[model samples]
Structure formats: structure tokens, C-alpha cells
Target: MANDNKDFFERVYQVAELIPQGRVTSYGAIATYLGSSRSARMVGWALNKCSSWHRFIPAHRVVNRKGLLTGKHHFPGGETMKELLENEGVQVEDNQIVNFNEVFWDPSNELL
Candidate 1:
């Protein structure tokens, strides 16, 4: 079980790292790209632990299905996630991304 969880987390990190600046994906999108559509929560869990990684993972580029910064609280500083996205030219307001679909990056489509 531990190995399985670790593998899942590693895959999550890989996908998170692949998220280009100025683009974002949802937890469900990453999970679905990994062939585990039901594991959206697991994707979020893996990203939550990403701070321990040696290299920086763009976990900030991930949001909920509704383009909501649901995991923002997990970041070290308040509004850090929002700041990161805005730095990448993704406008965020009221904790929700503006023009979400325009900035949404789908791994399943891009990686194909």
C-alpha cells in the first residue's frame, strides 16, 4: 500500500512539474490523465506533500474542477497560490481563476 501510494505521488509530481507557467489543470484532470479518474482527491493529496520534493513542483498550477483555489490554504503563506498564478499571467479573483478555460491545460490532450 505504501509503495502504491508513493508511485501515485511520484506520477502526480511528474504531471505537476509538466504544467507550464500561465496554464493550470484540475485535480480531476490530472487523475484522469493518469487513468484514474476517480482519484482526484489523491492527486490533491500528493500535491499537498510536494513541498518535501527536492525540485520545485508547480502544485500551484493545480486547482479544483471549478477553477477554485481549493488547495490554496495548503501553501505556506496566505495567497501564495494566487500570487504564483498571477505571476504566470493567470488572473485570479475571489479565490477563483478568471477565464479559467483559456488557461486550463489538459495533460491528456497535450501529452498525446
Candidate 2:
């Protein structure tokens, strides 16, 4: 069970790393890419525990399925994850993505 959890976290980070600098992906997307449609919560748990790796994982580029900045609390600035994303060229409004589909990065090909 421990090893399985570790593997899940590894894959979560792998998916997070694929999120482009100025773009974002949803937890469900990463879960689907990992072959589990119901693992979105697990993905969030993995990211929460691995906040130290934000430099490589781009954890700030992940939002909820509704495009809400649900994970903003994990950002270093505490309450400016959206601002950081904007600085990276991503447009955000009301703590939500303005054009999510336009900036979504598909990791299916890269993950395989």
C-alpha cells in the first residue's frame, strides 16, 4: 500500500511537470491521464504534500475542474497564486481562469 501511494505521487508530479509555464490543467485531467477518473482528490493530496517541489511541478498551474483557483493557498505568497500565474502570462479573473480551454496542455502524448 505504501509503495502504491508513492507511485501515485510520482505520477502526480510527472503530470504536474507537464503543465506549461503560462497555462494550467485540472486535477481531473491529471487523474484521467494517470488512468483513473476518480483520482482527482488523490492528485490534490499528492500536490499538497509535495509543495516543496513547486519549482519543477508548477503546482500553481493547476486549478479545479471549474477553473477555480482552489489550490492558491499552496503558493509561496500565500494568497497570490493567481497573480503569479498572471505574471507568467496567464489571464485570471475572480480567482478563475479566463480561457482555460485555450491554455490547457494535454499530457496524454507526453505521458505515454
Candidate 3:
């Protein structure tokens, strides 16, 4: 069970790292790519603990299905997630990514 979780988290990191600059993906998207669409929330949980990871994971590039920055509060400083997205040239309004479909990056379609 521990090994399975470790592998799952590693897979999540790999997919999250694949996200291109100025693009974002959803927890559900990453979970789906990993063949665990039901584990979307788990994906977010794994990312929350990603600070301990040796490599830098662009966790800010992940959002909810509605393009909402649901995990923003999990960041150290307020607006950190928003700042990261804006830095990548992604427009954000009310904590929601504008033109979400345009910026959305799905690992399933992209990694193939």
C-alpha cells in the first residue's frame, strides 16, 4: 500500500511537471491520466505535501475543474498561487483562470 501511494505521487509529479508554461491542468485531469479519475482529490492532497519533494513541482499550475484556484490557500502566502499564474501569463479574475479552456493542459492528450 505504501509503495502504491509512492508510485502514485511520483506519477502525479511527473504529469504536473510536464505542464507547459502558461498552461494549467486540473487534479481530475492528472488523476484521469494516471487511470484513477476517482482520485482527483488525492492528487491535490499529494501536491499539498510536495514541498518536501527534492525537485520543484509547479503545483500552481493545477486548479479545479472550473478553473478555480481552490488550492491557493494552501500556499504559504495569500495570492501566491494567483501570482504564480499571472507570472506565467495566465489571466486570473476572482481566483478563477480566465479563458480556462485555452489555458487548460490535459496530460492524457498532451503526453501521447
Candidate 4:
């Protein structure tokens, strides 16, 4: 189980790195792309632990299915997630992405 968790977490970081600066994907989408459709929460858990990584993972680009910044609290400073996305040109209001579909990037489709 330990090795499985580490492997899955590494995959999550790899996918998170692929998300475009101004786009976002859901935790579920990453899970499904990794062929672990039932592990959306696990994906989130992996991203939450990404601070230990040697390189930037851009975990801020991953959001909830509804485009809600549900993991905003994990980004260290308050509003850091929102700030990162906004800096990428993704608008946010009330902690929710405004034009979600336009900015949504699905790994299953966007990636091979």
C-alpha cells in the first residue's frame, strides 16, 4: 500500500504539471486519466502533499468538478491558489472559477 500510494502520488504530480497556466482540471479528471477513476480524493491527497517535491507541481491548476477552489486552503498563504490562477488569467469570484468550461482542461482529452 505504501508503494502504491507513492506511485499514485507521483503520477498525480506529473499530471498536475501538465495543466496549462490559465486552465484547470478536476481531481476526478486526473484520477480518471490515471485509470483510477475512483481515486479522485486520493489525487487531491497527493497534491496536498506535493510541497515536498523537488520542483513546482502547479497543484493550483487542479480544482473541484464544479470549478470551486476547494483546495485553496492548502496553498500556504491565504488566497494563494486564487492568486496563482488569477495571475494565469483565470478569473475567480467567491472562490469559484468564473468561466470554468472555457478554462477547463481535461487530461483525458487534452492529453494523449
Error of 4 at 77 (Å): 2.1
Which lDDT values do the candidates have, in the order given?
0.95, 0.83, 0.95, 0.94
Candidate 1 lDDT for residue 33? 98
What is the Å distance of residue 63 in model 4 from its true position? 0.5
Q: What's each prediction's clash count?
A: 0, 0, 0, 0
Residue by residue across 53-87, what tens digits does model 1's lDDT show? 78899999999999999999999889999999999
Model 2 segments beyond 4 Å from truth? 53-55, 109-112
**What are the clashing pairs of model 4?**
none
Query: Per-residue lDDT of 25-72 in model 3, one digit per residue for the tens?
Result: 999999999999999999998899888898999999999999999999
lDDT of 4: 0.94
Candidate 1: stretches off by over 4 Å:
none
Better of 1 and 2 by lDDT: 1
How much does each candidate deviate from the true structure in C-alpha RMSD?
A: 0.9, 2.2, 1.0, 1.0
Using all chains and alpha carbons, the TM-scores for the candidates as numbered come to 0.97, 0.86, 0.97, 0.97
lDDT by residue (1-112, candidate 4, tens digit) is 4998999999999999999889999999999999999999999999999988888899999999999999999988889999999999999999999999999999999898
Q: In candidate 1, how many Å is residue 83 off?
A: 0.4
Off by over 4 Å in 4: none
